[model samples]
Target: MQCVNYLFLVLILTPILSTFSAKILGLFLYPSRQHALLGTALFAELSAKGHEVTMISTFEQPMVQKKFRHVLVDGTQIRQKYSPSLMSLNVSMWEHIVFSNSEMKYMIAELLEDSSLREFLDAGEKYDVVVSELFAEALLGISHRVNATTVSFNPTGGSYELDYLSGNSHPYSYVPNAFTAYSDEMTFWQRFANTYVNLFCAFSKHFFNLPMQRSLLKYYFPDAPPLEDLMNSVELHLVNSYYLFETPRPYLPNVVQIGGFHLQKPELLTVELLKQLDELKNGIILFTVGSHRKLSDFPVQIVETLFASFSKSSHNVLVQYEGPPPSNLPANVRLMPWLPQRAVLSHPNTKLFITPGGRSSVVEAIYFAVPMVGLHAPGDDDSQLSMMANRGFGVCFRLDEELREEQLSGAIRNVVADPVYKRAIMLESELFKRQEMSPLDKAVYWVEHVAKHKGAKRVKSQPAAAMPLYKYVLLDVVVASAALLVMFAFISLWLCKQTYRVLIRRRQTEPVKHKIV
Candidate 1:
């Protein structure tokens, strides 16, 4: 009987295992360049692991033509009648964080409402698993409709609610007043903030999904966790930050961390670029605001201040300027419209890196062991690194007017001279290394797991919350009833006590009255 039971179990599990080992399709949906790169990288890596993968993106980059199937989701093509300018995209992005909040929800709704985007998805492609950023939450209904498992991939150190989905404790709670920005670590306050943001996020989702405003919230989530974890609509979550970069916390079994997912084949520099870098023997000081922002776009005063600071520096300066060098370019400075960053960072003569804290740039610096004089590129670029600076990972420069040339010079000197910063970074590098699994392998493993077992079905696609704030919190009944009970109990207790006091006083009053008479 036992043998028969075991045989039946094996029979059931075999078909599931077989399904997970076959071909799969992945949905990589961010329209932004940085996020597009991440999605493309995952698609390539997953395809290499022996699955048929199709990619969808917003732009025309080299990755689209690669070995895997590609779907070019030209939002411009979608908005054929209404091409949103790049600047408009930025403005909308800004409003998203402050106003819309759950960018994923807003984007998903936008995509859904657009007939072009839906037509793109309806092209009759079957997917086994869906890997997307948390911001991609607005489209869970589609994923559900198609029967796919979803995975949330994060490259940045995430807030606590995100950490909860990743199966570990946030690191901040482990150490107090230590690292800044994001620790993948949660402080007590950080956890509180996560809760607050989640509550706000659910409402934000409501706003984004106003088309479904009335009945959606009521029917959606019957067993949802707090609002903070609202859009964690994935079967599994993979965070790009490692235990080394972030603090560990308790997460569900499905959450995972595969740091250094952005890593890839090294860039080979042009001979001209290499020669230029080598000639800067007094050592090189490089400045870049990252690909998203052009250096010449810096405020005139800030550009003047940087030029003034370079005049006093002992090292030769290399700044990636879009236009000609600033008129004030000192004799020691060399302006190149474009510099291969990997080559510059790897150069023997390069001593200090001066730039915004792009994750790629940060990793490149770490890889090359080059110290940085970071002037955080304003907005989301700096938003992630503001905490990295606080954690003592790098020297953060305020781009404010008060930051003069002398301060820049001093900060450069401090970053270059300080050995501890290097030590801390080296230690971080080692931790990053230890957490390093070939992300390609992990991604493949999961893809295959889904295909073999038809494992994707286990994941549900709707919001976890079954009811709205008014119903879930039970505020209407709980608050009113509790308030009334408290008032009634207080009044009854006060009346009884007063009556007892009066009787006792009356019993003792006869002696006092006789004396007084």
Candidate 2:
């Protein structure tokens, strides 16, 4: 009822509030396909709202509108510089962050030096707003270049770093980092590890990342403001996360939660695929590891175990296998190079989804009200899957576990046979769908508001991004308080000792008088 009233108010005011369309620049340099889709959605909505949009992205769309221009920036060149073979399942969190930072530094440098991008910068193209993805420090330069009101597009929702920068309360006492497999209710060791990792990354960014980003920004645009100034000047943030799937925490007014902004009504599945699903009365189970990790990368023994389990299962299995599938597969098992993932999940015959627990996948599955069996790997996958399990919508198994046929098959069987997973997911889906305004609507509204208002600085926390670590975390205040307490303690102890000595001296002086009497 409250949501209905809020949305009704928005609908009534939308026409009155919206007055003008302005020039917008959308810059997305991330190479991942998922991120590319998100970037596309943002620009598409802006174009739909009659704004003049210029987009620089890896997955470029030919301009559908006369006012929109698309520029293709080849991300593959940067990707090729670092071989994909360098990444493996065994990589640690610290190593991953360091390696990722190195790659981003080079990528940003390459992007800035690109002849076309350099020309764009020199062309003096003025934009009213600049919307750039928040992952890379290099992308922040675009906002500075255009002198536009900057809005950060974070595919992953607000993190501690962003929250800290924006002066939001992101307490290390409770909240866990994305890299660690810990929840808000963490064990002592988990909390210690989480704090250690956050502090380590924060320090590393200060000493290592900031200097490199600063140097690169200066090299590209010498007259631009300092890198920290550019970041702090951001007027708004569009984060791709929902509150239900996340730990409940406070966010800044400028930070908007726009998770599921890209989701659309499901597209129809192919006739052949639909037929395959129809034949299975027991229902279908979908398996995918997302875009980055191919099924071929798995060990032969692991594949054999999965195949055996699928062969024995009563359910029909649809696996997104990029390579040649097993030669002799079970009659019920099917493989495809690609499947419209959300569409397939929406099918009535679909029973369970088996995934590596990527954020987009988990959110989509929840959107469709499907139970999941997650294979937890290192990095964000572990943390996300653990969260899903804790929420009771799914169960998670560590990929590092020793494999057995029954373990895989039994888990699937339990998910299919159990009613709890189904009930929980359905309820969650209901809550997820009962939003006041669609994520896309909220995003479009906020974006246009910024363009019309010339920025959202009034709503943003003041100057927190440029604040030093000691001040931001109150380390200085803590040290000062400790020092004061120590001084007071020392003074009190000295007074007591002086009194004790005087009393002894008085008694000694009185002893001569008493003897005379």
Please, what is the whole-model Cα lDDT of each candidate in the order they appear? 0.59, 0.79
Clash count of each predicted structure: 35, 0
Q: Alpha-carbon error at 285 in model 1, in Å?
A: 3.3
- Give lDDT tens digits, candidate 2, residues 182-261: 77898889889988988887877778777877887787778888877777788888888888777777887888988887
Q: How accurate is candidate 1 locally (lDDT)?
A: 0.59
Flag regions of model 1 displaced more than 4 Å: 1-29, 63-66, 75-96, 99-119, 141-147, 160-233, 247-249, 323-325, 331-349, 377-387, 390-393, 455-517
Regions of candidate 2 where Cα sits further than 4 Å from its true position: 1-18, 62-67, 80-87, 264-282, 490-517
Measured with C-alpha atoms, the lDDT of residue 100 in candidate 1 is 33
Tally clashing residue pairs in candidate 2.
0
Q: Compose the digit string of candidate 1's lDDT tens values, residues 1-517.
A: 9999999999999987765233344455544556666676677776665566766666654643335776565555333322233212134323434433433334444555555456755665566776656543434544554556666676564453353343333333342111134344566787665455555544544565343422332234323333334344356666665544434444444555555565654557899887777776688888876655566755788888888888888888888888766666799888787677877887888888886676667766766777777875333435335545655657787664567888888887777777877776666666555543675567656656655665443543223322344744568899899999999999999999999999999898867545554
Model 1 per-residue lDDT at 298:
59
The superposed Cα distance between candidate 2 and the true structure at residue 398, in angstroms, equals 2.3
